[model samples]
Target: MAELANCPKCNALFMRGPATVCKDCVKREEEEFQTVYAFVRQRQNRTATVEDIVRGTGVEEHKIREFVRSKRLHPAQFPSLSYGCEKCGADIREGRLCSNCTEEIQNGIQQQDQLNDIQERNKKKDLGNATYYSMKRDKR
Candidate 1:
C-alpha cells in the first residue's frame, strides 16, 4: 500500500509509490532529463563530459551524475563520463569502489579471517587444557 509522505525534492505531501518524488518534482525532473538529453544527443556534444553537459544545459552536476549512475547515460557512448567512488572519491566508470579500494578491502578481510582462525585454534587449545585439568582433579 502507498503511504502519505513528503517528497524529497519539494517536501510536498503525496502518496509515496515507485517514484520517491512527488508528481510535480517528477515532471520537473523529466523536463530536466529532456533538456540534458537533447544537449548530449547532438553529434558534436556526444563525447562531452559531465561538466560540459552541465555547463551547456544548466543542469546540476549531481543530477547528471544521477543519470549516469542509473544507466540512463551509457559510459560507452561518452568515454569521459564517470562517477566518484564511494570510498575514495576517485573517478570510476562502474561499481561502487575503484579497483585499488576494492583490493585493500579484500586484503583487510583476509587478514581479519586469518586472525579469527588463529583465535579459534587458541580457544580450542585452552578448552582442551581446561578439560584435561578438570579430568585429572576428578580422578584424584
Candidate 2:
C-alpha cells in the first residue's frame, strides 16, 4: 500500500514508506550521519556539542538534532548533545517536553477532570429536582 508523496528534502515525487524522505534524501542523510558519527567518535570530540559537530562535520544543526531525537545519536555518549523542550525551550536529552511542562500539563488535565465531574454532578442534581417536581405536580 505504498502511496506517492513529495520528498520533504527535495520536493520530488516518490513512493512513501518507513522513511519520510525519498531514497536520495535518505542516502544523503546516511552520509551526513556517517560524517557526524566519525567526527564525534574521535577521542578529542566525545564531548563535542551539536554546534561543534555541525562545524566540524559540515552538517546542519537540525540534522544532528534529528539524529539525537531519533536515538541514532545517544546522549549518554555525547553529554553535550541535547534538544530544546517544545513547551519551555529547556534543554533535554529525550522526549518533546521537559519534566516541568509534563507535570504542568498533568495538573491542568486533573483540574479539567474535576471541573467536568462537578458539572456532571450539577446536571444530575438538576435532572433529579425536575423529576421530583413533575411527580409532585402529577400527585396533586
Candidate 3:
C-alpha cells in the first residue's frame, strides 16, 4: 500500500511507493544518476572516489554516497569508492560505521552489560542481607 510522504528532494507531498522520493524528484535523480554513472563508467574513471565523481559529474557527494550505500554503485567493483563512517567520519566501503567505531560501540555495550550484571548481583546480595529472623521461639 502506498503511504503519503514528503519528498526528500523538493519537500513536496507524494504517495510513497518503492522509491523514497516523489516522481518529479525521482526523474531528476535518474538524470543525475545517469550523469554520475557515465562519468564513472569510463576506464580511467572506474576507480574514482566519491569526491572525484562529484567533481567530475557535478553531482552532489551525498547523492553519490547514497548510490554507493544503496548498491546502485558497487564499491567492490570500483576501488576507492567509500562513504564516511557515521560516527568517526572515516572512509568505509559498507555499513553506516567503520570497523573501529563498530568495535568500540560493541565494547562499550559489553562493559555496560557487565556493569548491569554487577548491579543486579549487588541488589540480590542486599536483599539477602536485609533478611531478619525472630528469636522469640527460644523463650517458649
- Candidate with top lDDT is 2
lDDT of 2 by residue, 43-139 (tens): 9999999989988999999889889989999999999999888898888999999999999999999999999999999999998888433343555
RMSD of each: 3.0, 3.4, 3.0
Give the 10-residue window scoring lowest on summed lDDT in candidate 1. Answer: 131-140
- Between 1 and 3, whose lDDT is larger? 3
lDDT: worst 10-residue window of model 3: 131-140
Query: For each candidate, what TM-score against the reference?
Result: 0.88, 0.83, 0.83
State the lDDT at 39 in candidate 1.
89
lDDT of 2 at 134: 38
| Candidates arranged by lDDT, highest first | 2, 3, 1
For residue 12, what is the lDDT in candidate 3? 100
At residue 131, candidate 3 shows an lDDT of 65
TM-score (C-alpha) between model 2 and the true structure: 0.83
lDDT of each: 0.89, 0.92, 0.90
List pairs with backbone clashes in candidate 1. Answer: none
Question: Runs in model 3 with CA error above 4 Å?
Answer: 1-6, 133-140
The C-alpha stretches of model 2 lying farther than 4 A from their native spots are: 131-140
Worst 10 residues of 2 by lDDT: 131-140
Best by TM-score: 1
